[model samples]
Target: MAKSFTKMLRAPDSPVKLSKIPSDAHPGVDSKADALRKLPKFAGRLADLQERLFAQAHGGTKPARQNLLLVLQGMDTSGKGGTVKHVAGVMDPGGLRINSFKAPTKEELAHDFLWRIRKALPAPGMVGVFDRSHYEDVLIVRVRDLVPRDRWELRYGLINEFEQELADQGTTVVKCFLHISRDTQKKRLLARLDDPTKLWKYNTNDVAERKLWPAYQEAYESVLNLTSTETAPWYVIPADRKWYRNYAITRLLVETLERIDPQWPPADYDIETEKKRVLAS
Candidate 1:
């Protein structure tokens, strides 16, 4: 079921576009260990691409702008943080703004879900990450019935429209769902229990939430059905196989950034004159 949902999300529209294997298709992948091997290479490539993006921004001076936003969603224990750490660690921090989304604070809940998200949008020549995002309104809020069915149902159009606006404005947005099996989550949860220092990360609330796995699955299906768009689609990362998941997501990011073909801004004709003028000082 997760496999089907993930496939629907990542399938390319044209044969010419680079293709990537959805992680959910792989039942086993040790993403952490594999990430150690692939991170240097992929991270290096991302850094190189980011340098071009940075040049684009700096060259703009007082002119154009561009940026990207990556939203990651997953069940508890999914490797969202790990993937972000390894996959995006190479990018320039000068323009990067990674926002880790969690349960809304009282002040945040007073407004719409997207209100908080809007505050974190990436500036030109940077990337932003939503650890968990507005999608939670469609997933958790629906699974837990925190809101009426109609209220949550309306969010699909809202999300689609929101993403459309971002895309129209030149923000390359990608949404990834880290797919983990119930058994895998159980194992990780147990390991979290036995480990001493990791104890602080354990939460009975997360365990209690595990009981509603089936509900979350259904909520995800609905969320995908409504929100998957050409501009911003959800890519499923297989969480069971950590290596494969890391590789798949890293590749997907590279593939997407490559699509943008972020180019360095052309050198202006006034550079010589500007340099001489500055040199006089």
Candidate 2:
């Protein structure tokens, strides 16, 4: 089932038009209620797999330790934060590291773009979540013309190489673009403005950014085309319906972890001896 969705949602090598994809489509999910009901089971499996991965990294004899990094990229109000809150929230916080990347600091700009990203990577046996990532160097920089075209254009290969290195080092990279339609984004933004509690989330800059929607979409299309490699492919998740978004992401995670298939390390000490020692004590 996961394989089917992976095939359906993965970006192909050809050019893509974000408008062509339906943001509200729920493949294989019958209804919102059904999605909600299945979420807990996927969540539980994710927790268990994460625990096993953590244990294996700590105790397994393998030379390269294993970890998972989930990279989320999306437009404003496209559900990146919500995905982290709902899907990743189910995992044990002790084993998870959620990093939200904003505009680079003066110090960060001093070094290469990936320097900060390297610092935020998950350690062996941990699951790391990046709310926005290195792709920003291409997306926002290109859209806002923060950097010259020549500079930002060079980053596609660099980003691909960086992810390839991570894969070589035993990190499973799962990238998701929370694909939302223009109308859906506007509706969500309006909702945030109308609700007092969500007013804080409504940023004036978001409105400014929306004015460049076409440019951002083109930038993202480039991102998906150039960087969706076999080692770390990108999944374009439908984000119009919050419930379905959560379900799809949770399922993707579970599937990725299952593929990694970490196991409980064998006991280093004799189990009988430990049991007897504890009982005697």
Candidate 3:
């Protein structure tokens, strides 16, 4: 039987509903060390793919622009930062870009939701990662009752159209939601509260919001349902284990960049020759 992550977890709204895989599917959970021992293989595969992406830097066109975009969305403590850091670490500086979005300022909230997001697009020949992306439109807005349910719900179509545009324009958009069990998340949050060094990461308010876990879960389920597509599929990662989460994200990114196959533009030999002749004259 093929391994299935979905069989184990509850279904999300995404068309490709992944129920949690049975415990028998991966007894690896019983041994964190053993499960972790498998990470190097996954990382190695990702590294190999990154090597190709690095080598192919400008293999595609004259201008050699690589417009790859990765959007990562997850609940707090889902290891979004860790995944992105490890994924981009293997690529050339020129091969990648990263944008981290925070709570919107009054100015940001004033404009259309995507107004701020569009301005952050990476230049040609770079893999741009959005730590938390426009999906927040569907996530936070719906959860906080900031917008009417119907209004926030409708943004899903707009998002699909927007991502489809990127796909048509040669940008490979890979989105992901780091899926951590609620119990696991609670434990992690509590750890943050207890650890002196990590205390600052813990916001008392976060616990308050966390108490409304059902609302957040519903919001995520809705976002996943409407947004997952062939052109821009959302990878639902198991993130209770940070190492596994990072490895999974790294693999997903490597696969997307490989598919894009960006290449550097070749120099115009005739123009160079003419310029050289003019210089000699």
Task: List, residue by residue over 1-281, the lDDT tens digit for candidate 1.
Answer: 11233344473443211114333454323446655775577767777877777678777445347677888888888888777776676677775788888888999989987999899898877878878889999888888888898898888999999999998887988888787887888988898899997888789799779999888877776666567677788776666776666666766666677777888787766889989999998
Question: Where does candidate 3 have its weakest 10-residue lDDT segment?
Answer: 21-30
Q: Give the best candidate by lDDT.
A: 2
For candidate 2, write residues 88-196 as lDDT tens digits.
8989999999999999999999999999999999999999999999999999999988889989989999999999999999999999999999999999999999999
lDDT of 3 by residue, 205-249 (tens): 887778877788777767777787767776667777776665556
**Which pairs clash in model 2?**
none
Clashing pairs in 1: 29-241, 29-242, 29-243, 30-242, 30-243, 31-242, 31-243
The TM-score between candidate 2 and the true structure equals 0.96
Please identify model 3 stretches exceeding 4 Å from their true place. Answer: 1-61, 264-267, 270-281
Candidate 2 Cα outliers beyond 4 Å, as residue runs: 1-3, 60-64
Superposed Cα deviation of residue 25, candidate 1 (Å)? 4.8
User: Between prediction 1 and prediction 3, which has the larger TM-score?
Assistant: 1
Q: In candidate 1, residue 71 scores what lDDT?
A: 86
Error of 1 at 76 (Å): 0.5
